[model samples]
Target: MKKIIFVDSTQIGLFTFQAYILELCNLNVGFGIYIETFDIPLVLFEKDASDVVRLSIDESLVQFIANKSISSRIERQQYFNQLLEFVKSSEELAAKIVFKEKEMEYLADSKYLVQMRNIYINSGNQA
Candidate 1:
């Protein structure tokens, strides 16, 4: 049996995520993970066992479904269909989550905002 993992790239703290994914692909590890990117079909990899361990990622969607050894092609197709429906329904929610994360990153990286935050903290203590 194989394993699968999901990674949301729209979120921060993923600096080494791409490198990690490539490493897994190069090493032909049975474990697989998928990450969503702004691009279509964001990232891809192959497994040695010919397992249908495929990944599909996009701006608001990150999904990876490893075909079970016991399952038939039709079953795999059903899994893909379900995943597509889930992505379609969750687009709005995913977009909101990604946007909020980016907004937080923007605020955290702003030196001016940091200085202002520090000033506010200091002034409150002086009261």
Candidate 2:
């Protein structure tokens, strides 16, 4: 298990013990949940390490999260504002080029049924 940190424009989401890079790829590939290497002063994951995958979130996902987040108007605005600042401060794009290329190569091979299966299995989960 690899410890990894994922920082976006506003907040940082930490994923502990990343087992496989392919699983991260599959996560984005299947769910459009973009997770990639961070371009920052302190490198979160080693360049050659495959256990940890960086998280790269974008604008569309922002809108999606905003809608999904059960926050008040002020809170949402604060979150969105922070995202804007991050976008302005950072110039490097999220680490998605490789996965994006592979997705293009195997466009039709998406396992949509697999996503449904995971969803069904987790739907009954109660916390």
Candidate 3:
């Protein structure tokens, strides 16, 4: 079975939260995690397992988040907490989740916002 976490990149601390989730998935060997960007779908992280967890983020969402004029650290933290809860919920939903191969392939080939390349590059360096 496979589970997916849809992330709104406009939220703050997204990279941090994603890193945290990836680490959690790493420690828990039962699940394998992969990251899918709006354009290119990359196996940013993976593990051997019978189940998969996909972190899906859109490039446009990242750009929107970056362009936002007003945001606070506290709000970002709260959003992160919500995401954590969503992940927990997804665990229970994993069994019921269904995905088609064609849909997955389309996601892999989709286009993403090119303006946020620097952010991704920076995050990659930090990782």
Candidate 4:
């Protein structure tokens, strides 16, 4: 069966908290993360077997779901719909970092965020 791990990005000690999501996300699974009202889909590996992503993250109200297998397109859409409500009521700080809807302008379109994920994972693993 697939697993679901929700990350709490709003908590203190980023590197420490990241370890959970990082470890699970590296297992070639369907890892996903959602913070506050911010919703961004994170995939550990893009493959046909992506399902039940064993996520390592903090627990929060706006829960991010990761499937273990390739879910139907329709099902995925429904999942998104359900998430909207939970995300809408989430905290603002985490929402800014998770969603691409922010108007920060500075790091808005920057690809470094993806890079930062890698860096965070790499560094956390070493510590």
Candidate 5:
């Protein structure tokens, strides 16, 4: 398993540092979840290893990905490619890109599901 650190802006204030632990669920695509406090995952490609792939998760699939298993590496790559194409091809999605949140089922039913959900629900503060 890979450990990625994320700095949550909402959690940072005055002088409080808290480490919220999140569990990894088998996406089954060989790709593990690298999400932090934020819903989006910072996907780094194998090529340059510097390029970050941003995923625009669909709302309908949020709970599904949260409840499903992970996927393989190749499957992840394919899914990523497909998402990229989807975003590029859809004018409605592309227009409101910044307003959408990304969601996937890779780390769905992990041991930390409850905790993760709690944190997300409490910290999200979204309408």
Candidate 6:
């Protein structure tokens, strides 16, 4: 299992961080649920020789703010304040994403079944 170390961030940055985590899951990378708080530079992920992946929450927040063009300092401060309320660690977030992905897959499969049933019914009408 690959160990992923994620820097913590706010709710505003959660979605973007979740995307990266989900991608890592798809790649079959494994990470633990340990949460550690500290000051670190902005980065997404770094892989070392020991197969440890480090993710920086500050980097994710910066990217999200830049992408949204949040120029106002007040809005930025609000995000920072809300960070205290964002509780889930990286592993938990990844789990949620995986669960949601599975749910969507199931829905898609059901849709295929419905389409097949419709096709069968239409063929019977034609016959």
Best by lDDT: 6
How high is the CA lDDT of each candidate model?
0.31, 0.30, 0.34, 0.31, 0.29, 0.35
Q: Which stretches of candidate 2 lie over 4 Å from their true place?
A: 1-60, 92-127
- Please give the lDDT score for candidate 2: 0.30
Instruction: Point out where model 6 deviates above 4 Å.
Output: 1-47, 56-64, 83-88, 91-127
> What is candidate 6's local distance difference test score?
0.35
- TM for every model, in the order presented, reads 0.26, 0.29, 0.30, 0.23, 0.23, 0.30
How many residue pairs clash per model? 0, 4, 0, 12, 18, 0
Candidate 2: residue 80 lDDT (0-100): 41
Error of 4 at 77 (Å): 0.2
Worst 10 residues of 3 by lDDT: 99-108
Instruction: Give a tens-digit lDDT track for model 4, residues 1-127.
Output: 1334454443322111110122234454232333333343332212233332122223222122222213344444444444332323332323343333432212223353334333333221231
- Candidate 2, residue 56: the lDDT equals 34
| Candidate 4 whole-model C-alpha lDDT, 0 to 1 | 0.31
Worst 10 contiguous positions by lDDT, candidate 2: 14-23
Q: Name model 3 segments beyond 4 Å from true.
A: 1-55, 99-127
Task: Kindly provide the TM-score of model 5 when superposed on the true structure, using C-alpha atoms.
Answer: 0.23
Q: Give the per-residue lDDT digits (tens) of candidate 6, residues 37-110.
A: 32222222333345444333343434433455323445444443443234234434543543333211221223
When 5 and 6 are scored with lDDT, the better candidate is 6
Q: By summed lDDT, which 10 consecutive residues of candidate 4 come out lowest?
A: 12-21
